[model samples]
Target: MKPLNWFRLVFSFIAVTAVCGFYLPGLAPVNFCEEDKITSDCQLHIRSRSLLQNEIQLFVNRLDSVESVLPYEYDVFDFCKDEKEKRSSENLGQVLFGERIETSPYKFKFRKDESCKKVCTKTYDTSNKKENVRLDFLKRGVELNYQHHWIVDNMPVTWCYAVEDGQNYCNPGFPIGCFVTFDGRSKDACVISSGFNKKNTYYLFNHVDITITYHSEESESWRGARLVSARLEPKSIKHNSQENSQSCDGPPMDIPKETTGILNVTYSYSVKFEEDAQEESGWKQVHGDVFRAPQSGMLLSVFLGQGTQIFIMTFITLSNRGALMTCAVVLWVLLGTPAGYVSARMYKSFGGEKWKTNVLLTALLCPGIVFADFFLMNLILWVEGSSAAVPFPTLVALLALWFGISVPLTFVGAYAGFKKTAIEVPVRTNQIPRQIPLQSFFTRPVPGIIMGGILPFGCIFIQLFFILNSIWSHQMYYMFGFLFLVFIILLITCSEATILLCYFHLCAEDYHWWWRSFLTSGFTAVYLFIYAIHYFFSKLQIQGAASTILYFGYTMIMVLIFFLFTGTIGFFACFWFVNKIYSVVKVD
Candidate 1:
């Protein structure tokens, strides 16, 4: 490569990095702080018809006004022997366990309720200064979404301290709680003997618990952090009350067993003030980073949409091996010059009538197949309320962009090819293409495609499980960097496996390497589909016809993309081997 070209690439990358690193902070979405007993920041955006169709049952959780309190619904198993027994009926009734899925937090709107509007205006005005100017604030009703989290093992217990005659302070914890509210508000409602304190304001003295609950497909419910432990730090905040000993230094707070049922590896939470985003909510853009890892199979589809474009283009542009990448490079040297130029030469080799089919199919078929799968799978996720579906419009645009560029390139090469003479192979074809090489399942295109998937899968299946868990399970998938690397590995494996198979087939005199290579590598997608089916059936018990259809719908998309990526590797690899072998032969 020319130094200037290299310099440009490096400079371009640097420029992009600078912009993302520097300017992004300001451009990035703004986040607000929340101070509830259990709080977390996350997003579950829905976008597209397929996704919305599946998730129609889930209404938008919003807090429209201040006078509203979000009603959270949860199922109490009624099995907890006592408060401490709020866990699964395991060997030990004292064990605690559960789940938590923190949906995206809501950004409170400034729009006030009608009733609160008048009071809000009057309360802030500093007009008539008499009667000690006492500011009497009205309690405006607000709304909250019900967040559901499940706890199977470690049940939650509450620890309380008697502060006033009618008020008390409570925290979620057990055993020797050490950590305090490293982050929480100073004055928030606290639950005492009666549960959550709605009418009383128990000044937060020590710590706070922000239990982030999100949906989990593994246990087939929502789950999050069980009370690991916590401490109360009264000295951190500025207290105006005449109380020197605001907090007592004790061993630790141990919540009693009676409060355990609330931890039933089962809980629910909705949303409040959701009108702004709700006018449109379904499959929103996916967040969290995308990367490759040893266990990155599950994220294959998620990362492909974002990184595939630049990634493949870079690979192709950088390799710039062009004819060198094919077996033709060797043929070019043996027969010299144009004899081994693959694009033009193979264009002729495929026969004019079939050339278009070959190139077009090679370029478009794989992506088309993958998208079909992707579209279908997205429908399934949409139904199951999973976020696996890539928006159809975006997907179509992506396809158009890829094929539009690639189609012309292939045709141009073909035109150049058909106008040229046939490549003089070191060995000439007989009256007809050779046949009769019976092979094992591991060698033929079909079985080879099937087997090629195993190693790549072995490298990533474990990771894929987690990825699928994060997606269907609704867990956090912020491990894109690691996944990206695994993507690289899968690429290598696909290419090498295809190449090895192609070389073997050619040595066996099987010249029909076109579709064979594509199919062989593309077969990996089949395995992926199989695994997905296994996951859905064995791992997830998602009810509803929508969920079933959506699962397979998104699974198909994953399969389709996988097909393209793997097929491309195989086709290119075999193409290289063919050129190299023919070029080396002494075609006299």
Candidate 2:
């Protein structure tokens, strides 16, 4: 009946069709054998070959116990060390998260199976004080059920075993050992086997059964295959004589709680291979236009960096809350350098001239906002004579951490970033801009941004309930694994939704998708804020204005951080998608 409505429907249909058609070819399975063999209905044929000389290296990451928030390097446990140890290069995020991945003693050749191969032997003599101390620390690690994270080919070497109800569970990390109490009660990994019944003893996982699954590609050009998955089964085995033992068998390696004599732990492993039937695939994108500087590029870059810092802080702090407030503040303060670096790099790439302003904004903008809000909240607490009020000394310490440490580090990072050359774009931009076409209601910026966040919010709303409960109701939140999975899902949802809407905007010839992209996913924070208001009234039972002010004030801080985090995710995703499409498509 209406011409505008009719036009909208036709335009939407055309855009969807064009996008699908453009992406469909890349999504389809292609024959690796020959370019001529590639067809619409071509079957994906991965031709893999067994490597003749493949060296599989196992890397040991930082050790962490469920009982403690702190993590330590592998060397702290005094386990068998690699003679020529080398550490893998870690990113800023990994370093901040306390990941210390280094070469381990475990090494194997591809396709060549080994059974009960001895790695190294560790002898702890009680006569030596240092040895005794090391032994005690090892025992403490066992008692606390400290986990060992092993990496193979950049993938986690999972420990898969049967759990309760006969269902199998795969743990990304395995415990250093198990502990048996004086009363004969077993803890952690001790429950996995009935053999760990020895009283007042520590059982060390000195042996491992490693299974590596690889995908073979049988191409004339390439000869070697790639590892798809790696799994290991840890065991505590005792050898009657280290010199005489050929196979890892006899009994569990148990150490007395209070040992007066010498103790030995012989680290060993067995390796096997399995051919993986399926091959993993990834979507490819182009780059160029997406990297093009947007309007208010400097401010956006600063926000992006701050957002990334908040994301890292939130992710790492979620596992334990014993020292949450203090740890989070410390992490945020320490993380300023990375934030400044990211902001300066992006701003520089965007052709920003005022480096000083960009760095200052990056270091101060978001943190200042949070501190100001917190100070206001603290004032309310002080006026109400609440015990929750932060002491003046604590404020001074925070200021010291901010100005004395964070500010200086941020400047250093900014300097480093500015010194580097700007990132090269895949395609060059024209000095003159193209005129954008008239947009319909659906294609408009605000409506599209509003719609972009709904899916991501939908993905995390249930998890948000638990988080809110942990914050307000003082409920213990320890389901970090599930929370992490939900976080990943939220990111995916945000990226896909933002990309889809971005495509729609691009199809409509609306080139101004930069801020829109960030805001599109960032709008999830608005929904989160709305949900908090609903939760405040419906779920929480509060009576005072000060209490309400405190609740909303703290919640606002969370919402702002979340806004930055989700917005950064969406912005980067859409940026990548736009770059990919533009680079791939033929343009005049």
Candidate 3:
């Protein structure tokens, strides 16, 4: 092996081993008991716990409707709010994804059960114009089937119910209300209960049965228990009281399509607890050496960040072409801070000195390449007089957003990252590079990398067909749930395949696995590009140089993003695996 290859391989091996050793032991499964019953079998080891206050607070998150892509804050629908409203701090990703989490009025004492507790009473008088508007807004929210996402102990308060085939499905959110159409058709949550059958009416879910489960920590170190799970069942119950109510049973809270009188909504909840058993399992590893940073660590980190941004954007907006394109651009622009932060953090951890260059490249390099390609495609569209061409003013606005918003945000994020401490590796690097033994054909760099992508490509090629159709064939693709599942599967497959290949290379006494790990999964994009060509010739019927150029141009952008995304996934996975294995191995 060449001197450079020897260095690369040794660095890759060290990095992978370090990560594996540090994190693998933390992946143990948690055990919990059912229905307040804690048998001796259930009393097992538990993870560390912090002392909790007697009071448990429930937080409210944004409300989103399936009928629309937009999400609104919890208070927007005139719902009850905390007297001293406090919002949780949001990360860049959470903010860009439109998550608004705030403190709610619901509070509970640990292990204390309450029944038929009145939260608040909301009255909408149709006589007043402002009240009418608020009522109308609430009714519209019901018509659109907006869902409420409540958070307890950092866990979503799920609504688990039976589905088809005797299976149970748990939804992380619950609908605010349900609407019965004038034609007697039920929508969304209306199907949950048979009482919501009044035609041209809305039924509000004003009552909830909340169940909070916690595991007791018997350790003398901690005083309180940790919450294991939180679940709720929403109901629409008509109540006459404006104050505390003893019983929460009545007819459904229904509003006619056109109401003339005051509409009363009484919110109440019942709370109970279940004790869960805790278990502890143990695995061990020793930390010795730090993973070696690969060559061009700055560029690699930038690519990783960009790829992560694209991956997240794609995951969120897997819909029709128009919405997809619009959302992708906006999301990509808003996500610049994350990209810069990730790139700067990784680059600094790799011991790179050129912070200014790293920040600039993180903000500009990949985006510049994409804009250049798009500009070429737009020129073709303009010359051909195609309606698909973006307007000049729109292009100018895009440039302004890129420079004015994204660039500055990137600078801010990079500055913050530079101010933080670099990531510490448990192991130290060897003074002298280890020599690599002769490699077999299968373990060689090119062959191993090529083989690495095939499994991941196979996992997504079928879904790729639908994605391509959504883009080029003008088909409506709304299977986001399944698409997300496939994306997860692709991640797992890429990680497993890369780890397997990296292990093979390491066993063969070759350490130049750094670039190999990235390219191994990254090569999947090559197959995607080839498939695009085959798809064009075999499936599509377009005849024009401009059109062909436009298709291939956009396809190249997708391919590049995919290359980065998959490569990042593989690289990190291999890095973790190497660190883990090496951490446990006893070295003299």
Q: Which candidate, 2 or 3, has the higher TM-score? A: 2
Per-prediction TM-score: 0.36, 0.52, 0.51
Candidate 3 lDDT trough over 10 residues, lowest sum: 280-289
Worst ten-residue run, lDDT, model 2? 279-288
lDDT of 1 at 43: 24
The numbered model that scores best in TM-score is 2
Kindly list the per-residue Cα lDDT of model 2 for residues 1-588, writing each as its tens digit. Answer: 654356458769977986776433213322122233433332222323122234677899999988988899999999889999999878799999999999998887767789998888889999999999999999999988899999987689999999789999999999999999999999988998999999999999989999988755552133345677899999999975647656676799989998988887788899998877653111212122334478899999999889888878877676444587788988888888788888888899899999999999998888899999999999999999989999999999999999999998889888988888987555676666655557799999889988988999999999899989998999988777678668768878999999999888776766677799999999999999999999999999999888999999999998999999999999888878766655543221
> Candidate 3: which stretches are off by over 4 Å?
1-290, 319-322, 586-588
Q: Relative to the unseen true structure, what is the C-alpha lDDT of residue 101 in candidate 3, on a scale of 0 to 100?
A: 89
Q: Tens digits of per-residue lDDT for model 1 on 360-479?
A: 544444445655665666666666666655667876766565555544554554456567786444344444323435766555666655666677677678778988998799887665
Better of 1 and 3 by lDDT: 3
lDDT of 2 at 197: 95
Best-to-worst lDDT order? 2, 3, 1
